[model samples]
Target: MSDFLVVGGGVIGMMTTLQLADAGHSVTLLERGRCGREASWAGGGIVSPLYPWRYTAPISRLSGWSEGYYPELALRLYEETGVDPEYRQKGLLYLRVEDEARAMAWAREVGKPLERVSADFLYAKEPEVAPGCQEALWMPTLGSIRNPRLTRALHARLSAMQGVTLREECEVRGFRQAGGRVTAVETSQGPVAADQVLVCGGAWAAALLEEVGITLPVRPVKGQMILFKAPPGLVNRVVLMDGRYVIPRADGRVLAGSTLEDAGFDKTVSGEARESLWASATRIVPALADCLVEHHWAGLRPGSPDGVPFIGAVPGLENLHVNAGHYRNGLVLAPAATRLMVDELLGRAPILDPAPYALEGRLAGGL
Candidate 1:
C-alpha cells in the first residue's frame, strides 16, 4: 500500500483521501483549520455543471457522472458514518428572460427533460415564487447535497478508515522537494514524509505553491450568500433568476446567493452584498421578503484562469499532484475530480479525460 500525504481538508481533499484509502492506500490529510469549514461548507450546494450547456464536453461529462454518484455515495457515507449528507433531488428551475431561441435549442441538444413552463405553471408548482417572474426551464435532473454534512460525513468516514489519518489544525508551511519529487511536507507540528503528495488547497493553493517555486494561476473569487429561516415547503425546487439563485434546504432554510467578487482572502460578509442578495431573493420569491434572516457567510472559490479545475500530476514533479482550482463548482465537482486523481495515482484510466484540466493546459493558456 502506498503512503500518500494530502494537503488541505476541504471537500476535494477529503474526497481524494477517501478515494485513496478505499483503493487500499494509506492516506494522511492535513488541515490548517477546522476541516471542511472553507469553501466546501460555504458553497450554495447547487449540484450542476454550472451552465451545463456551456461547459466543455469533458467537463460536462465529469459533472454528469459525479451527479449520478452522489445518491449512492450519500447513502454509503450516511450508513458508514451515521451522518446524513442531506442529498436532495428537488430539481433546478432556470428562469429565461432573454435568448429564448438559443436556450431552447441548447436544452434540446442536452436532452435533460427540459421544459419551458409558464409563470402560472411555475407558481402552481412552487406557490411561494413571485408571480411577477416570467417563464423558466424546468431541469428535473439537477440535485443538491447539504455541503456541510457531506464534508462532516467524509471526515468521519475517513477517520474511521484503517489507513487514513486526518491531522486537523495542522498548517502546511512548505514542501520539501528533491529530485523533482516532493519528499515531505513541513507543517506547524513537524515534518511528515510520504511516497506521494497531493495539494488540494482550495483558494489558498496559489499562495502555498509559490513557497515551492511553482505558481498555480489560482485566484480567490469571493461569493457572498445569505440564508433565511423559511418553512420546509416554502420553496420546493432550486430557482435561478436574474443571475441569482434560491436553494431550499432540507432543514427549512432557504439559501440565497451569491455575489462573485475578485477579493483575495477577504471573506467578510458585506451588508451591500447581503442586501442585494435579499432583494434578488425577494424578487424571485416574494415569500422570502417576509422570511427571517438566519445567517450570512462568504467564501473564496479557487478560480483558475480558464474556470476549470486543475487535476492530475503537477508538471516538473512526478510524485506531486494538484487537485485544486475548482472555483464555484468545487462541491459539485468534488467526486469526479477525486475519482480522476485517484485513478491517475494508481496508473489507471480516469473516469473522465484529464486533458482539458491538466496543469500543462493552464500553463499553455498563459494562466
Candidate 2:
C-alpha cells in the first residue's frame, strides 16, 4: 500500500501525483485507460478562459496562479523527463466584433494589456483573418501548452520514479470505506489499500464518488474539437470568437473548438458539431478554408454550476480528498489545484484559499 492512491490520470491527477511525490510521499496513480488520454489530451489548450476578468475574483486568482506556474512546471518536467511540455506564451488575441465597450472595461479592470484594433489592424497583423473580423482584445499574458505532450511527460516521469507506481487500464469499481473514510479502492483488477485516497476522475468524478456514498456536483459536459494542419505561424496566438476559440500549435497544427453539451459519457464526435465548429473557426480566421482537418475528437469536461473546481477533502471522510470538477479549465488550473490538494493531504497550509473549491457543500444532505 502506498501513502496515497489517486484515481484518475488526467492533468489534475498526474499533477497531484507530481506534487505528492515531490513532497516525499509514496503515490500510486490508477487510470481506467491510458494516462492523460481523456479530456486533458483533447482540450483546446487555452490556458485561460475567454473573458476571465468577468469571472469572480477567486476564480480569476486561481487561473492566474495556474498560468504563472505553467512555465516553471514545464521547465521542471522537461529537465527531469527529457520531454518538453511545449508550454508556449503566445498570448491570446480575443476578438469581439460585439461588446467592444465591455471588452475594454474588462481589460481595464483586470489590468490586462489590451489594444483595440480595427479591421485594418486585423488585416495588417494577420492577413488571413476574416474581412469582417474587426476589433480584438490582445492579452500578452495568455498562453497555451501542448496538452498531449505534457500528459505524456508526466506519465513518463511518474513511471521512472522509484516510489511512484501507475496502474494503467485499471478502472476503479468501488471504494473500501470504513469509519467514514475510504480505506482503499477496489478496481477491476484488485483492491489497493492506502492511508489516503484522492478521487480526481475528471468527468466521471461524481459517479466514482457515488460508489463511496459521497455526492459532488460534477457532471459531464461534452466538448467536440477539430484540428487543422495550418502553417506553424499561420495564427501566432490563440483566437477567440463568439464563444469558440482557435489555438495554434508550434507543430503546424491549429485546434478549433468546441461545442458544450451535457452529454453523459458520450465521447463520440458529431457531424453537426464539427460543422458548427468549422463555421465558427472560419468566421474568425478565413484562411483555414484550405486547411486539412487533421484530427477530430470529443472529451467530457467535469463541469460545476459555479465554474469552480472541487479541490479539497472529501466531507465526512478523513484521509479522503478530491481534486476534480475543473470543467474547461482543468489543464489551466492543474498546477494550482494539485498543489492545494497535496497540501490538504499533507496537512500543510495551502498557498491559495481553498474555500471556492470546498467539496463539503455538495455532499448528500450537506454532510
Candidate 3:
C-alpha cells in the first residue's frame, strides 16, 4: 500500500503526486486514460489567467504565487527530464478594453504592470493585428508554457522517482472506507490500499466524490479551440479580445480559442464554434485569415460554483482530500495549488491563506 493515491492524471494530479514523492512519500497516481490528455493538454498554456482582475481574490492570490514560481519549476523540469515546456514571457495583449478604468484599477491594486499602447505601437509590435484594433493593454510579465510537454515532463520525472507509481487506464471504481477514513480504492484491476486519497478527477471529480456522499459541486465546462498552422513569429504574443484569445506557440502554431459552455461533459466540436473562433481570430489579426486550420478539439474544464477550486481535506472523511474544480485556470494555478496541498497534507504553515480555498468553508457557504 502506498502512502498516497491520487485519482486523476491531469496537471494538478500529476504535480501533486510528484511533490509528494519528492517529499519522500510513497505516491501512486491513477488515470482513467492516458495522463494529461484532458483539459491540461487542451489548454492554451497561458501561465496567468486571462484578465486576472475579473477573477475573485483567491484566484488572484493563487495565480500571483504561481506566476513567480513557474519559471524556476519549468527550468528544473527541463534540467531533470530534458523536456522543455517552452515556458516563455511573450506577454499578453488585450486588444480591446471595454472597462479600461476598472482594468487599470485592478492592475494597480494587484501591483501588476499594465501599459496602454497606441495603434502605431501595437502595429509595430504585431503587424498582423487588424487595423481596427487601434489600442491595447500590454501585460509584459505574462507568460505561457506548452502544457502537453510539461505534463509529459512531469510524468517522466515521476516515473523516474523511486516511490512514485503511475497507472494509466486504471480507473478507480470506488473507495473502501473504514470508520471515517478511506482504507483503499477499488479499481478495475483490483483494490489498492492507501493511507490517504486525493480526488483530482477534473471534470469527473464530482461524480467520483458523489459516490462517497461528498457534494463537490464541480461540473464539466466544455471549451472548444481551433489551431492554425502559421509561420513562426506570426503572432508574437498572446492576444485577447472579448474573452477569446489567440496564443502563439513555439512550433509556429497559432491557437485561437475558445467557447465556454456548460455542456455536461460533452466535448463535441461544433461547426458554429469553429466559425466563431475563426472569425474572432481573423478579426484580431487579419493576416490569420490565410492560415490553415490544423486542428479543432474540445476539453472539459472542471467548473466550480465560484471559480475557486476546493483544495483542502474532505469533511466527514479523515483521510480523503480534494484538489479539483480549477475551472479554466488549471494550467495557471497548478504550481501554487500544489504547494498549498502539500502544505496542508504535511501539516505545515500554508504559504497563502488557506481559508479562501477550504472545502469545509465552501460547504458551509463560504467563498
Candidate 4:
C-alpha cells in the first residue's frame, strides 16, 4: 500500500498522483471507470474560462497561474511521454460578444490581451467564420488542447513513474478512519491502506464523502458535446458564440461543444442536444454545416455553487483531502489545482491562495 491514496482517476486525480510520486511519495489513484474519460475528457480544453471576466477571483487566480504554465507543461509532457497533447495558441475568437466592455475591463485588470476586431479583420483572420459578426473579442494568448491526448499523457507519465499506481475500474466504497484520520480506503477490489487519502472523484465525490459523514455539495451536471469531421485547416482557431464553442483539432476533425444541463449523473447523449448544438455551431461557422458529425457524447461535471472547486482538507478529517468540484473547468484548472494540493499535502509553500477554494461555505451552499 502507498502512503497516499487519491480517489477519482480523472485529470485532477492522475495529475495529483503524478506530482506526489514525482516528489518521492508513494501514491495510488483509484478510478470508478477509466481515467480521464469523465468530466476531464468531456470538456473542450479551452485554457481560458468560457467568459474571462464573468468568473470569480479564485477561478481567475488559478486559471491565470495555470494559463502561463500550460505551454511549458505541454512541451515537457511531449518531451517525456511522447504523447502530443496538441496544445495550440491560435487564439479564441468570440463572435457577437454580449459584453465586450466587461471582457476588455477584465482583460485589462488581469493584464491579458483582448482585442476588438472589425468584420473585415475577422473574416481575413479566420476565413471559415461566418461574415457579418457585428463585433468580436479576439483573445490572442488563450487557445485549446486535445483533452483526450492530455489525459493519455498524464496516464503515460504516471505509469512510468515509480511508487505510483493507476487503478482503473476501481470504485471506492468508503474510507477506514482511525480517530479523525483516514487510515485506508474501502474500494470495490478491497481495502487499500494509506497514510492519507484525497478525494478527486469528480461528480461522484459527494457520495464517497457521505459514507464518512462528510457531506459536500458536489453534484453532477451533464455537459454534451459533438464532433465535426472537417479538413485540418478548415477552422483555424477556437470560435465561440453565445455559450457554444468550436475547438479545431490537429487532425481534420473539430470538436463542437457543450450543453450545460443539470442532469444528475446521467451521461446520456440526447437528440435535443445534438439539434441545438448543431444549430448553434453552424451559426458561428457556416462552413461546419458542410461536414459530417462524427460523434456526440456527455460528461457529468461536478457542479458546486458558484463553479468554484473545493480543494483542501476535509472538515474534521486530519488526513483526508478533496480536490474535486471543478465544475466546467477541470482540464483548465488541473495543473495549478494539483500543484496547490500537492504543496499543501507535502507541507510546501502554496502556488496560489487557498481560501477561495475552502470547504467552509461551499458545503452549506450545496448543489
**Which candidate number maximizes lDDT?**
3
lDDT of 2 by residue, 64-150 (tens): 788888888889899999998888897776666377677678778867677776677666656666576646666777879999999
Please tell me which model should have the higher lDDT, number 3 or number 4: 3
Model 1 residue-pair collision total: 0
State the lDDT at 348 in candidate 3. Answer: 88
| Local distance difference test, each candidate | 0.86, 0.84, 0.90, 0.88
Report the lDDT tens digits of candidate 3 across residue range 21-98: 988999999999999999999999999988888899999999999999889989999999999989989788887779
Poorest lDDT segment (10 consecutive residues) of candidate 4: 358-367
C-alpha root-mean-square deviation, candidate 2: 2.1
Which tens-of-lDDT digit does each residue in 1-367 have in candidate 1? 2489999999999999998888898988999998999999998888885467766666666787788899999999999999999899978887754655666677777666677888887878888776766777787888988898999999899988898988999999998888988888999999988999999999998888887777788889999999999988989889987678998888789999989998788999888998999999998889888889999999899988766888877888888888988877888888898899889889998777778878884654534
Clashing pairs in 4: none
In order of lDDT, best first, we have 3, 4, 1, 2
Q: Sort all candidates by TM-score, best to worst.
A: 4, 3, 1, 2
As a whole number from 0 to 100, the lDDT of residue 220 in candidate 1 is 90
Model 1, position 87: C-alpha lDDT score: 91
Candidate 2, overall lDDT? 0.84
Candidate 4 residue 326 Cα shift, in angstroms, is 0.8
lDDT of 1 at 348: 96
Worst 10-residue stretch by lDDT in candidate 1?
358-367
